[model samples]
Target: MWQKHNPARELRSLLSRIETVSQPQVGLVADVLEHACPRLKSTLGPNALVRRLIEAEAWVDLGFWLIGWELPDWAVHRLSCDDSRWSCAICVRGLALNWVEDVAEFQHEDPALAILGAFVQAQVRKAQGHGPSNVTIFRRVERSGAVSMGPEVER
Candidate 1:
């Protein structure tokens, strides 16, 4: 029997493929974005929302939309470091460090992508239902055989 389709895994797979900072014209990544945000579908068909946000580099807006969709009670915190990397985290409201994961905190060259990665990780954690316990971090291996401690890109 085929295993049931897992949205978290699917989202993570798509997240790994998006390596570039530019808006994608056509691909699975765009499809995943459309699938995640149903509210945008009626307003902007298919990947239009993702493309528009990426084109505008609207990281905070995208992050807010994604987090609000997944966990309405949660809030996102973001920071930009001196090394030109951006980190994003999702947490329960009123508790700055409670119930959030370092796994959700991802540093990326693009803040938008960083938020995207954090959203995916937060989804994965939510799906797994593990809260502040397991901490086995996995590094993403690129197609080029390079190992990146940061988030991986699919395309």
Candidate 2:
């Protein structure tokens, strides 16, 4: 007889892969920003805006854990369990990165926050069986950045 498939075990395996990437560090951040933005090639012209947008995106990915989020197929699967047409956190982040053009554009008003908030709210609700719908996931993501800096706050 064939063995039964276990959802939790599958989820664990997926989470492990998502978490295994080395944490984003300063050197890696610099390299990604330089490569994606290419400051030297940009001048005071139309390409300057495009370069700025690319740099902002690279910063968001490195400054946040967007790349790790992107790598996990499981995360996407989990979030879209109810509806196949829905986009997950990773996709939302990519969309946000593309939308953001500069540092000033990186704020709560950004659409990235809205997408992240919805995704996080869904996860929290799934985990707790119930939770506030309006809770912002950016708070948790921002907390992760603080934790990386060695000073974590109590939630």
Candidate 3:
């Protein structure tokens, strides 16, 4: 069966491969970044930017650069462990006028890869309309210890 493509799974595989390589090539990383964030299509300097960052071996900076294109407003990353794993968190600005107050997290041994994964995950969720602002979430109430559907609410 031909299954649909899932960006999250693809990101995991890409990051895993990157981890084994001593130095990930610019072309591969750049291609992945472009595929991950299509919004960057409006810009003409991505390739050059990728080359510079890769040459500098600036993984964290690459992550931030990607985030700037995706969620230009705000994003953050943190070192989750001393083993060099990094966790990235981002605020998804939904289609609604107000922010949905949702956060998606992704981790990787390389900070850039971690942020890249988070970017892909967040973008996928947003596109699928996963947040409360985009979809109506069904609530459940307990009646005699039995769960029943309650009013639909927007988180």
All candidates: TM-score: 0.57, 0.20, 0.57
Backbone N/Cα/C clashes per model: 6, 0, 0
Off by over 4 Å in 2: 1-108, 129-155
lDDT of 1 by residue, 21-116 (tens): 444334533654654554455564435665676677565576667667555555676556548777776656654454435346666776766676
Task: Note the Cα lDDT for every prediction shown.
Answer: 0.59, 0.32, 0.63
Q: Lowest-lDDT window of 10 residues in candidate 2?
A: 99-108
Worst 10 residues of 3 by lDDT: 92-101
- lDDT for each residue of candidate 2 in 1-155, tens digit (9 for 90 to 100): 98776433443333333233333334433433333222223544534543454466543333234223322211222223233232234232222233222001111223333233333333333334332222233322355355343334455
Residues 1-155 of candidate 3: C-alpha lDDT, one tens digit per residue: 99898765665565556546544457657756756667667678676886688789787787778777666644553436446676776764444344444665776666666666666666656565663333344578666696778674345
Superposed on all Cα atoms, the candidates' RMSDs to the truth, in angstroms, are: 16.4, 20.8, 13.1
Ranking by lDDT: 3, 1, 2
In the predicted model 3, the residue pairs found to clash are none
Give stretches of model 3 more than 4 Å off.
1-28, 45-47, 77-79, 82-84, 93-101, 131-155
RMSD of 2: 20.8
Q: Model 1: number of clashes?
A: 6
TM-score for candidate 2: 0.20
